[model samples]
Target: MNKIISAHPVGAGLKIFQNDPEIKIHDDVLYIPRIPGPHDSNYGIYDSYGRLVQTAGPRRGWPNFSLGQSQSSSISPSSSYPRATENSYFYGGHIGTHFGHFLTETLPRFWCAPHWYLNKKIICHSGDTIEKLFSVSWIKEIFEMIGLVKEQFIIFDRPTTVISLLIPGASFEENHFSHRQFAEFCNKLGRKYAIDLGISDPIFLSREKFKSAMRTIEGEEEITSILRNKGFRIVYPETLSIREQMGLFCSDRLTSGFVGSAFHNSIFCSSPRGLALCYGNSYSTNFWLMDQVNDANIQYFSTPTLLLKNSPRVGVPAEFTVDNPMDVANLVIDYYEEKSVLKKENEKINYGKKEGPYLIKTKFNSFLQIDRQLGKIHAGSGVGPRIHKIFAYVFDSQWIELFTLGGDVLSMDQLDSVSDTLNFKMQISQNEKTFSLKHPVTSRFVSTTPDGVVECNREYARAWEQFLLISANQN
Candidate 1:
């Protein structure tokens, strides 16, 4: 897998490791061909296994701007420091600019995206009293849920695991990570947190007295009054706690807000009938909010603000009133009317709640995950292989389906199956605490082959046949 990209090393004398690296290494130390800066996050040191080789002292994006404190030293990039101890793991990530950062950039990097190497511990910038950065709570909940709360997380200001992981940021490389996969993780967490904290009244996201008040709507009071008079309870989302905030928004069916961080909370809301957004010309992009809101079956309507060119300030909707107020009000009214009709129909169908027969929830082995499995259903045409685990879902017809983990379900075959063996009965052993999966058509139990092939050719269930039905869903 190694090809010498360049015949000469940039430095005096160094040996090329593999691929066509930016530089060469020599001795016990790797004399970097290019000297990096203090805040250069692009530095990467890798092993043969493709894992990032960690270095001591400050990582790139530290002093978490939110935390206002970093353990990184004041040493210059030219000075020599102790290399990261062999096998020493760490927690690392980015200090993103906005709410969209948490949804699209931050959490995905931490939990769902590929890093220099896999890290169990995480570092966060916490704030219990502060009004900004709702990230710490989300980080904590994730660590706790993943069974990593014991020693897997570290916060800049708070006490947790104080290690640093050598992971690259999105800027260092392309984020081939799946957005849909990240959304599923959020959905799972939203459901669990929502269940813990009871749901609340329909929320009207108000930025009237919020910190980022510049981007607020023109005549916001009138707009808010229109919503309040209808049914929305004007809510300042930043004032409340994370769990409480999630519960309030997740439970509501209809919502409206001037496009900003407050409205980004719609990430927790699942399958809503309609969501209204008002934005200024300067605030052209909804950021990752568009992905979350539109994905939830929420009917979206925008009141576009247009004004004179070269306006220095952004999100000032009041300065220009290009769109008619009556038109905006009509759209809002029409949306609510549709929302009302949809809610009743949903009630009749019991639409939102997922009903299933199989109970697939538990703690899986650390290095191995049987909680979810994906392999060649068949190596023949139309069958496939995947990077992530395959998911199982129960349809309205009460049949089990093998769904794609990170790819399109339809593009890959959504294999529907009904195990006819023993009428879908599993040989669950209480003494051993193991269960075996049986293939109905073959009548043999599912077994792992030496070649990593999932086969049902075994006559009797053995160690490979036994499986753990661990119940952790990324939604």
Candidate 2:
């Protein structure tokens, strides 16, 4: 890892746009189309001055890591590209796919859409057709909530030159805190369109449905069970419509959940209120900005655990188990409940487990064999249909315990070392057949090096870093 001697978070020092509707108008602009592939071309609008309009696209990793700043991928349009005689206002590009990003990044500039640019056509590089662009029901509802009709959108796929383009500066920085203007816009819009559901019970936003192979929290069910017994209602945000979510989150009730886009729904709350967040591994600085803008009484209960696999991004954690779900649930229970009404169910909560004597192999089809004498793991035996060594695994809460068929434990320390217990997290690949083991205590993956040496020291799980688990039959 390349260490920075003097590292600083870029967010605290960012220069945000003023809290007002500021539109930058450019005449005779060229719009470039992106050709999707291994190396997709950057798509954006370029002005007559030969400068890519910064407001036309989203900038990721801003004010965070040094490499976070996204450069303008806007290239010159070819002469053969079609020209649009009409003018349109810029909306956003590829960032619209995600709900959080759509709310924070794509629609932030649209704070001026209702009054200033209500009649102007909005142009974006999101999809080919308006139906495809607004394919998501809630997203379409949100656009309609802001008075933007389907006819008002101009979805451009191929290269097209425009006579005029109006670019509204984002009221908030991409990865930093949002401005008061943007916050107030969401507040007013949410309240205006919010249906009166009269939701009273405290809600726990569950990420169960949205859980992906890359970022799964293993012990979330146990935590949810404990919270449920304490009177916290478990809610899956994906199951609710945009209006229902707005109404639910806006109600005068305590909201708790793992830090994610669901928590971002708090932006629609009538005002800032109490939020109990279950956090593990790393967190985004954007939460701080959210709290700052919303004035939320945010309480973070850290459920620390090392990520099992590596995330695609630098700061994102791949997979982790909540160290102590009961501790976090207790904190939320104490903070929310005035009196404990249910105790019988809490005692019956059982954590899930997976135990197997399985064979572990590398992507190159090499079996992983442990050398107990040296306390080292290595890739051994070439591909063939024959008998070989096998391993067994047990789940300890969300932690995975790797053991030899002979009952030797896999430890970061030597086999017989009396150090802290080594905890491993198993991450299943997208294909589901392959898996990668991560050493949470040391934040390393059980990876095979270039020379075919197995070590729990890989930072990322690339092609050679992946492992496949095969179920072995016991005699």
Candidate 3:
């Protein structure tokens, strides 16, 4: 384990540190030796006075201290390392070719580049070539956005020493936390790059085209179809240019999709808008961090899924199926479509009136019915002429409590309404035909599991969880 060192704080989002003082370079310029790898044991950075720069070293608590470990440390360069030829900015450490990492972790350090180093070169320790970097159109566009050109990048493939190596502290950290300066930089880009082409249609960013389906949701096609039917333009973000992608997300419109790197494009939103994310079994805090800066109205829907141990996709280590596609779709539709309108509608519902001896239907095409013998609720196969399928919602001062109904009266156990299991807060659909139910107690949705067991245990409401109330009393 390498000893952790402290870096001198120069300003907000700026730190200076040193390591391995033996190979010294003169003046305030730090000598960032060729980092063979994090485990090389000798590679490090040093200040003018030979003090170690802590920022260049491994941060404690990272697994094997491998946040930025060099995967190709053993591969030596074909030629000798380039000598110190010209002045350059130190753009070393945590540099990568990954799009997501470049957007969040790597590009942030260069936020100050245009102001100070417009004429200077950027010295990077990564062995990747400029040609490969340029091959990624979005990466090249991002460079142009920051007033940087490919000519300014110096790929340090071998050991080299230089003078006055200006090292800037990272504006954003690994855990998705970013400095105020970084947020300001992003907002400035949002304003500069945001183009208004008069397009405000709701967009569903689909990752179905990506070759690597990491964390891909199974039954995503079914969900996409539902969104498409609701007038959401199904957008495959990879097919669009960086500018086009930015233009769509940066606008003040409803944006939604499966939670992944493609969604990270929301960082460029000049103005906050309605954003919905459908998640599999797992979730990422990166979106939450982006929300802290963007302030968009974001809603999350969880699709109950069983993680596949042997995923079919080539690069995907894990993938999950949407346990109830209809349920998931309804949750998203309710959020993007009816959230604002339903707020007013909810205020008008007279909880005391006879809402129903209602037949509750789920997106699964199943009817919510009681299984008295099991003392639990289950989604029945169809809306047959069964008394258990008929139910009523009773509001107990605050929450909409559900109870099994026998004939026209509410079912009773020991004289009181028998509602020990079902409780909800309802959001009526725009057409008043369907309703989304949220548990008043657990704050989850009433959903029918894959096996037909009904429970108010979903984090977000979906079609399987949404109830279409057919009031028997209504003519």
Candidate 4:
């Protein structure tokens, strides 16, 4: 059997030093070329007689030597082989180290999208304080649930991004003591894990841009009073934007807020380990929108908070009072710990399942709700032809035709005219099979025959029912 020997200096050049002087030495180390597949470089180094020795790499770095031999004849090494040093070899970086950087960079980018949309792109509405509270809690819960603890490496085989929300004017000044306590808590955790607490800067809203909104609420005085009462230092609004304001909440690994704010969106998207505390009140609109923005498989923890109240004449705001901050804190802690439990439950429920149909159902539900609201279809006589035109513009041609022609609404002449112009028609045969207009619209029509139509509808309904069941099972 052939063996690799360490290179030693023989005069001006290097030579391999073998215990058996009869073994020829190469330039530096001996080389055995053309080894069979499935055999390592060190293979066949020993024989049954216990003769050959195998040494790999340079003498300084790879000093260890071993022997392996078979019962058959021993092989010799080539004299022209060159020695390899430790520096010449390539080794990959540690998975944990790579993951840490990925979480730091990509997490922030994902979370910042919602903030970018609200503060820079959309100008339809401004966010509120209650929303901020809910968002903070949600983010904290999601992080804990995902098991994003310090020093632990999470490998994401697929491409993924994080999304978080950052409230514009939320402050930790009133919770200064809590902030300090949290910082200490993080420090302790860091020490135990032998990891560093790498906290990023806070994202806040631009105070100058929202001067009118800020002034209307006498925000400065109210915020200062609340902070002082909560034993936190008073923070000025003008100092940062909403994105920056989120820095305070994320001072620790744990943080939370409502589902609606751009700040919350940014944080949720950016956090490597993110939690989202969703108030049931905002689930219909804001939370749904958040789900669209993040796409991070966000773990939602429900908080028992009222979003709206009903009255006979005019609607009034729900009570915004909290009796105990400690209770809220305890809830936040418990939520994070429960994230793993929820994730395991989710895996068990969704195991061996396909996700495509569920995604389609979610999209359909959104389309249906928006269409009903915008078309005033549920408002009795209030809806007119103009609303139908608007709906046509809002929904894709396929969806418009699907809802319009599949229902009894086709009896109306106006809808027929619209369908004709749109080059779409929905017809039910004697066998109860549905067919679409010929050509381009056929693909959009979902089903073109009675049995197919029934089957398609049943499939969609069954998929939707399964989705609901999965959701219920998760809860």
Candidate 5:
């Protein structure tokens, strides 16, 4: 096998390839190695002291080492590629910078599904790390062909983090300590990744420690009050139902923690803009599955040191100190502003009226007249100078009876008077399949039926009138 420098090392021992017979090293060019047995396919690089640096390939065969340049591969150059423009087309926070490399190489092939594309494009929630990452630059590249910025924009704020507690086990202390460490790691990650705010479950306290900490935080106030005043929201893992916890996570703008199965369950129902921050030192099956699901943005944070040991802790308890939440909050604000500006410019280019004549067909027997000053609908006869109200209501329960009654009903000059009193406009075609109405308070109400008349409830009529009033006020 070709020998390469190891990126990670343990102690003084250098790790090396085993059972690879077809590998060759020529002029510093390392050739692909052929592995023999189930374990033979594994390859590794070691330091001078036999410490392992990096490992690749499976145990049974050679791994594909192509750098995503194969023409036959799904990630070919001709794929729907993002624009190469720098700040205008691509923008991200700290974690974004770290994870950006993977998107460039994998997204074209992996994001082939139309649903994933749609979910990525039309975001319903904003004001979070994921929203900021998407709105600032990536969204522009995807929707540049269509003016996306000109539409109305609404942002929702999430202000809490929920944590799930693990069951007690043999290694409970180790798990608890590891969780604390993970919290600290995430704290650092937030700072580096420019995440402005974070909330996490406080570390479970030992009997002695819990009482001590409680006393210290509260000199005169009750323990709960002091914690609340200090901007802490205490949550018990068992207190919340699964659905409630999922709701919290789904609503959170950004969340970071271990790769717990609970997080997976929560994210399955989360909004598209939700972000799941996973610790690097975990099994990550749920995280991998989440990537497969492609619902929300999943970010994995790992340090070079964590790579040396294949066995990293999972579901550990730890205390994490968040430095500043305002920074992230401000960045989100700026991203939204940029998105708004870009959206407006795009709409101006795409919105225009059609320049051709069009015909409208309907099946109703009644007709309508249009109001010039106020847009509304009214019931009336076909021959009229002013607006008319076209009323179609059924008193009979049976369809035939209703039709007979409607046909035999007397035509009222009072109908014309009622129409005039209401300042209604209406029109009906000779075909008797369609009608329109314009009322004083309500705008035009159009309907079509084979019999030319349609039924309306009292509530609908009243609502229509109210709608017209609102429209008039706006005008």
Candidate 6:
């Protein structure tokens, strides 16, 4: 086996982004291990001391060999192929299908892998080209979005060199902390990738109906028609390209249907407040999905997984039911149904509903500024950059600002109230999927520059001007 020395994690406080991590450089080359074909759900990395690469920061003395990170493996590139040329370029590509597997079972490894160096080559360990097993375009699109460039990917056609190769576990246990961290990271990736790829902005459906898979959801036909009548679009994720799937997921305010890999779309899409994974009794099968959804700060609730006698077992236990689907549908609708009323001005607007003093964050991961301005254009410019809570609520037919980051609505005549200027409301409107935050009492949207610094008084219509309204306590 080829030996790697001075190999350690990139360091602490790194953000998880993609499926392939740049953990350490071996022989002056960075290695991105391949996910074994059969076991696609879990994987990890360990140093020669058998120490699993750690999430603890450098201050914690991470990559501590004393921790015992070693795990057993059966595959060794050294045994199968000739050693890699001492100074030749080597790349690893990763591949997988099955949305559930890809999201929970597959992605977390790459998410937390070291990324201290961005200039190195990143090879995908896909057994075949990513396109062969799944939608090739979609795979490439996701990889690039996560920071992998087309120039960095390479295919190993012949046994030129290799020695020992990294192995990502397929059936390994997923780390709860990492999964949650990655879930939020994946949500950001989904939005950024969709916008970058020009995936059309989504139309928010109160209940997007999707029931195409063969999993026998009892009374599915009736359920489908009922949801359709209730304004849910009959979406089939499998039929749509990855781009289209992302657009629909990112745009939709709420999406629902029988739980399965199809809903894996939610991993990357954060627009929805609640994703109702319909189930009947199989509470155990849904936790992985629940953990993922929760990590993204999106609400997930289960109704029932309906199935009949003699129904083939497909993981989740089935609960027999004959009640009208509308009753079950109420579980989601009651929570998500957007309330509206025609106004005297000939416009439909939010009427009587729970007005959220919700917090706002940019689709790109910046915390919204409440200062009516910002301190630094870039959040990562220094240590402990201030992240404040910026809140909003519906006003004048748009979601207007109730408070900005670091400041709140002035309740008393105290100095705080004077600084906030609560009387002059800031106009906020959503353009497509992005929210445009406007100046207090002006038409200008609260916007920022390419580097994230607040641009003074700019007309906000595009992405840099947009923000997502996450409920209070969501981060």
Best by the lDDT measure:
2
lDDT of 6 by residue, 1-475 (tens): 1111111111212222224333433332222243445443223332333333343110112112212222422232233443444343323323455555555544554554435214444334454554464455665666666666566655444422333333332211222223344556666677665542232322222223443333444555566666666665666666666656655556435555545565556556654433444443222223333343334333334343333655546555443453456655554454455432212221223444436777656656765443323322221112243444445666554535355556543221111112342322234453445566543322344465555565324434566766666777654
Q: Which stretches of candidate 4 lie over 4 Å from their true place?
A: 1-239, 246-252, 265-273, 281-298, 305-318, 323-326, 336-340, 343-475
TM-score of each: 0.44, 0.62, 0.58, 0.25, 0.19, 0.45
- Candidate 2 vs candidate 3: which has greater TM-score? 2
Off by over 4 Å in 2: 1-11, 14-18, 37-41, 61-80, 87-95, 127-129, 276-278, 304-317, 337-475
* lDDT by candidate, in order shown: 0.39, 0.60, 0.56, 0.25, 0.25, 0.42
lDDT of 2 by residue, 7-81 (tens): 112222333333675677777777765444324445667766556666666664432331121244355545556
Model 3 over residues 1-475: C-alpha lDDT tens digits? 1111111111111121122112212333333444433244334454434455555533322112434434233323322434567754545444556667777766766656475557778766443567877777887888888888888887655455564566666655544345556656777886788655465678777767776535656777887898889887888877777777666667667777776677667777744564444443224445545655566556554443423545455555466666666665665676676643322223223457544456676777677665454334577664444426546564532345556554233322111113344455776766666677754322445666666766544665566656676664661
lDDT of 4: 0.25
The regions of model 6 sitting more than 4 angstroms off are 1-81, 86-94, 109-135, 147-175, 179-184, 195-214, 247-252, 269-271, 282-305, 311-323, 337-475
lDDT of 3 at 120: 72
**lDDT of candidate 1 over 20-97, digit per residue (tens):** 112112122211111222233222232322223332112222111212222232222321433433343433344333
Model 1 lDDT, full chain set? 0.39
Model 6 quality (TM-score):
0.45
Residue 331 of model 3: what lDDT? 58
In the predicted model 2, the residue pairs found to clash are none
lDDT of 5 by residue, 78-168 (tens): 2132322211111110112112221221121111123322222221211234445445443333233222341312121311111111111
TM-score of 3: 0.58
| Backbone Cα, N, C clashes tallied per candidate | 8, 0, 13, 69, 58, 29
